[model samples]
Target: MPSRSLTDPPRIAFAGTPEFAARALEALIGFDCDIPLVLTQPDRPAGRGMKLTPSPVKACALAHGLTVDQPDTLKTPELRAPLVEAAPDLLVVVAYGMLLPRAVLDIPRLGCINIHASLLPRWRGAAPIQRAIEAGDARTGITLMQMDIGLDTGPMLAEHVVDITDIDTTATLHDRLAEAGARLLIDTLPDLLAGRVTPRAQPDHGACYAAKIGKTEAALDFRRSASELGRRLRAFDPFPGGLMSVDGTPIKLWRAEVLAEPGAPGLISRVDDQGVVIGCGAGSLCITELQKAGGRRLPVAEFLRGHALAAGQQAQLPG
Candidate 1:
């Protein structure tokens, strides 16, 4: 392949879907590259009204007046035709939601590069951001990798670590990682286009998969240790949301902290204006914020004013 001049920006075809992906697209737009086409998922019903909503990448592409394609699947010959004809220098994919086949992968001269959320070889599937927090990892970060057929088994081009804080939720962590991923992608693009960055194979050992988060997984089990449950609550927040049942009434827990106290699992050992302290199998957690079914999330004092939960009440995972 002939090397393009350093002054020339590489032609790029971007594939992405969500806000995380959109952020990368946004970063690329600010770069000197030419994004001729953007491939995203088809519009789907979303939110309370169930209105047809475009993927964040599609919206961003449209706003920038770039051509966009929302193919249900990229495996079709017809869909792959445009990509082949475009003959892009590189294919940049981030959170595109669908796997790319070999036919599509071969279209780009420079090949495909992906911006994945977690450090390569760890938390390497659908829900990396949430999985890292749930597992209580002290740090997680973005990995720019050369795309291959395997699931995030691609060789690493660049990586940057971001620390996970005590109060960080999935939502907050996601945003921070999105920006980090964006910046990292832009920084790496120059070296990648210039052929200065070399791909490194990810280590086979100590690798783990981050399976997608399920709504059912959000059901809080107080029978577990308070520290574990507290992390789970933060990890699942602003997504499926952490759920629990207190005295047979359904509730969603938004924020909690381990209290270093012990009592019978599922028992409400104390309740005051500060919060509701619930006993776990090993320790206790002070639920600082919660919401009743069909109600907005409220502080412990506000929630207590409307629906009283006194000491001796039990909190458990919903059946």
Candidate 2:
């Protein structure tokens, strides 16, 4: 742990939810800094029973015996009072899933800082990790910025990039970026406290918003090139996984490899222990892992044992 000899460690109020945010919070705790309060989204219905479940951040905070608040809306004056009461010198937001109105941003003495998943001025909106991977970018990383009212328009304090491997899935990339962001935050906090690092304005020219990934976007379209579908397969893995329909049944694709071949789109060109190679518009995709709706995820050979998928069978995918 880096030792600081300031008059006092700045009071920090963290706002976030999900695993990514939890990682940041954990890093802050490990630094032995003062965390007065944590704000996370309210627990909501999840999974089969649709029962309300606390976010991972909330659970982690409680386990650490830290104070936590779950406010549905921060736009109102009444709801914003608690944040003021916390009297945080700095506000750090990460994957909070809610927009911060100007009032909340102005509450902290040092202003609010955000841990964004992408290199800002690039994928500026939500779902940056998924969008970067889906676009098949060679690299993506984390950015620490001073928050502004506009969406992720904050000036950047620091950034660190990581290469995107061919096999890197959304889940894998998300974890790596989160860890990287946490380290960057720790390294930059001293400069922020000393008022040494000036936040630089982001270039407006290359700004692009990463729209939230939709459930329907997970369905793989065979009419598209194998490389395109392959990117989607990697981008949506572990959540809203890529899918294709065969005989009106939905098959979730978890792992796949692109191959050079030509045949009718959606046609099963080959079937082997590795997987069923399905033809695409330009090439083919060998699906290694898959799952049927209401069925367990299985290897290609195991899935083939229960469900008959032979060569020459036509598969339909959503557009």
Candidate 3:
């Protein structure tokens, strides 16, 4: 281990990717500790032009003048050697896409701890934020846990819950969780380093996986209940956005509200300055915000000003 006096704050090595992880890294920068290194996913092609983009965590680490490593796999000895050489007292992970093998996990004196986006044993997988909103969960939060071999089946250190509001989309919920998690991590670290906090094994009950959201799931099905479809529109915001075919032209639904009106599913029941009321199997949905293919997102009143979608028309599911 790197030479250090007991009075010094713990030496930390952080590994993470994405904006959520970057937020936690930002919090750590303000702490009274030595951050030996930061490990983030490698840059990848993105956007309409497909230009190479560095991950949010990598960019943040660089801005803070911290050493950064973007290895393809940490399991290999050559790659793992540098981490062991750093001799971090603790390893902090947040949304790191790749799993750390047992060899690497054993390197840190205090072992690896993760700031997961969901309560332990619930929504434990790749896409907790999106999964919670998609599942219509009333609430979700962050969990600080001791990492192990199993997927998020680790012992819990701390947890903080946040309520899910009606207006909350995936984008909104994600920001809340990120901030809440950052605060929780900072508060828990001191206790953790002093051996005051005890790790509790997570119960086997209430386990569910939050699988990665697929592009295919974007296609909206009017056959489902309006309430469920409305939730989906909020869940998939700024992602594979909720999709529907209007008179054979593809349109994206951004925000919607359920209505009590009943009519044939998929058929347009009403079109006014208010919104587009589309029928569902159970009830109806008022699509207040929408966007046509190759057009800007607009309120229903503005969308109807140019392109026309009237009653008797239908929004069809893409095949």
Candidate 4:
């Protein structure tokens, strides 16, 4: 909705939270886009100190001297005033966390564009990075789409596909996708602003919600196949993690590999330098990295030095 010609640079407003969003903002700044204001969620208590922490987006905005706004909700007219006054031509929203009401969406002339972690219509909600890996998806990518009222249901503008390796964890995949999204947005901005890009409706099929991840789902279930368990172990790393209880001592699994051999479920078939091999329903898993409740993740050899886990021991699994 900028008054200037379509080829001219339009005033872009940005909204986002977290490190993922911060990366995109950094890209926009690097591109020398005319960003007048940044919108992010309010500061929240974080870390063991429970001190108020600025969202990554806000921190980046302040560092770059960009005007920042934090509102509890944009549903009210008063809360949406700053955005209205900014009069941005287009709003680029990443993982802003808060939903934009209809009023806020209509403020910009060209509406808003979102940078999503997964290819739209696939993982369409929070925690897409973890869900894709947990679901054993072979490939995942970033989707830049127009924003609508529905959850990630808007038409897609473009996408950058990223191959999912067998060993990728949510933490690892998240970094890759975050950078990819930044690059994709930069590459597509000119065409999008110039009206050279067309929005294509997402397919009706292949739709699924990526529900937010919770700590409760971190426990490792030996009843599942080794491959499934292995994927989960990698997916949950640096988060709730793959939990297992041995001799009543809870441990978090960081890295693992599936094996063809089988033994009684929850049974430990081997424990040596390779890993702590544990049996599952279909096969076995070699757990290479582990952490204690309050300790750091360490290689199996280092973990063994502090804990006494023998091959005959059984890993406690949920009944």
Candidate 5:
């Protein structure tokens, strides 16, 4: 590797789409890294109007005055040709949504580096942040790995861990990990450019795939223990929140805590200012916040004002 002065920054091509991806781009740009081009997912229909909306990464790239590309697919020769022409020294990929073929991966001189949301060899697929909390993992973190053809089976260059708390939600953890990943990437860039960073292969043991969260998974199953239900409620809080049916209307569980006692699952165990205490298979859950179909999130007291949830009544949740 040729040694260049700090003033001569490496030409980097950043590929990503979501807010998490934007954070890394922001860090790279903050350090004035040679971001010659930014590639993100194509704009798609969003919101009630279904108007095409640019991804967070695209918006950030444009804001930074960086050249942007919204390629629908990189497998095409036309799309991959321009990226190769750019002659980027390194490619940085975050949540870009589309898989990169080997042809595209081999374009950059230093190959591609990805800021994955989880520690490699564990939670290697999509939805790692949510899955970690849903499974009640003790800790989760970020891994800067070399991109490969395999599903996040890349060699890791760096990693940082963050402990998961009982009250932590997916939103909170995602933000923290994104910031951590950005700092780690920026700190490691100098070494990466100097060819001092060595990639380490991940172990096959303790590997788990975090399948993307589906709408059906949002349906709360009260038959599960309170602790398990509580984790789901927290894991899915902001998106596809743990849901139940009340008079056939889908009710979202926004906030909840587990209780120690046993009762009939889905039974209304208690009701208080905080919220309603619903029984699970082995324990109970005190729902502090909730929302009904076509309704806004509200505190338990506020929700009770508009709806009736009496003690002893059953709350049926989908399995």
Candidate 6:
């Protein structure tokens, strides 16, 4: 690619879905980037009414009166034509939820770049934020990468590191990473377009794919350690949630603390205003925040007011 004059703003095409990508698009608009086209997934049914709703990226584009396209796939020449016609110097992909095959990748002048949620070549696939937390990693970061045919096996343009806190859930970590990526993209874009920065290849070692989180995995298995169970609750919060069943009624666990006191695994050792203390294989887990199925999440104190839990009761995986 030819070096760009710093005075000339590059024509960029944006592709993404969900709020994470929307944040980056918003940043670009604020920066006055010359974005010619925006691509997002097609509208899908959402909420209780199952009404068709545009993705967050699409909504942002429309609100700004930018040209927006929702292509189901980019495999066909027809579907990829709009991107080619835009003549973009760069294509920024952020959580777009669609794979861009090789044909689509060659359209940009400076080439396609991705803003990934985790530090590559670690946690390289879907659900990186939650997986990092679940795996008890002390740090997770945003990687700005040069896109390749291989999944996230791309050369790094830049990266911004963010530390993970013990209390962080997927929701909290996601928000932080989104903002970091947006900042990193704008900061690096000027130099990148001017051909001032080199793309560093990712190492072949220590790569891991983050498989998508499944609702079935939310069922808390007390056979695990207290720390593991606590992390699971935090990792899955604001989604499927950590599940525990008492007398066939499924309760979702939102926040928990690992404790030293222990009993038989899956046995409820104590039930009080403090919280519900249940035994794991190695330690005890204190359920601090929880909710009944179809109910709002509540503190343990508030939850116990309307529910019955007793010491020595066995907690089972939700069926």
* Candidate number that wins on TM-score, 4 or 6: 6
lDDT of 1: 0.91
Per-residue lDDT for 38-119 in model 3, tens only?
9999899998899989999999999999999999898789999889888899999999899989998999999999999998
Model 6, residue 4: what's the lDDT? 60
* Stretches of model 5 off by over 4 angstroms after superposition: 1-7
The Cα error of candidate 2 at residue 96, in Å, is 0.3
lDDT of 5 at 315: 79
Q: Quantify how close model 4 is to the true structure by its C-alpha RMSD in Å.
A: 2.0
lDDT of 1 by residue, 1-319 (tens): 3556857777899999999999999999999988878999999999889999999999999999999988888898998877776668999999999999988888999999999999879988999999999999999999999999999998999999999998899999999999999999999998898899999999988689999999899888788999999899899988788888876888988999888999888899899889899998789989999999889999999999999998988887897
lDDT of each: 0.91, 0.91, 0.92, 0.91, 0.89, 0.92
Model 2 worst lDDT run, 10 consecutive residues: 1-10
What's model 3's lDDT at 284?
98
lDDT of 2 by residue, 145-227 (tens): 99999999989999999899999999999989999999999999988888999889998688898999889998777989999
Error of 1 at 202 (Å): 0.3
User: TM-score for each prediction?
Assistant: 0.96, 0.96, 0.97, 0.96, 0.96, 0.96
Q: Judged by TM-score relative to the true structure, which candidate is superior, 2 or 3? A: 3
lDDT by residue (38-77, candidate 4, tens digit) is 9999999999899999999999999999999999899999
State each candidate's clash count.
0, 0, 0, 0, 0, 0
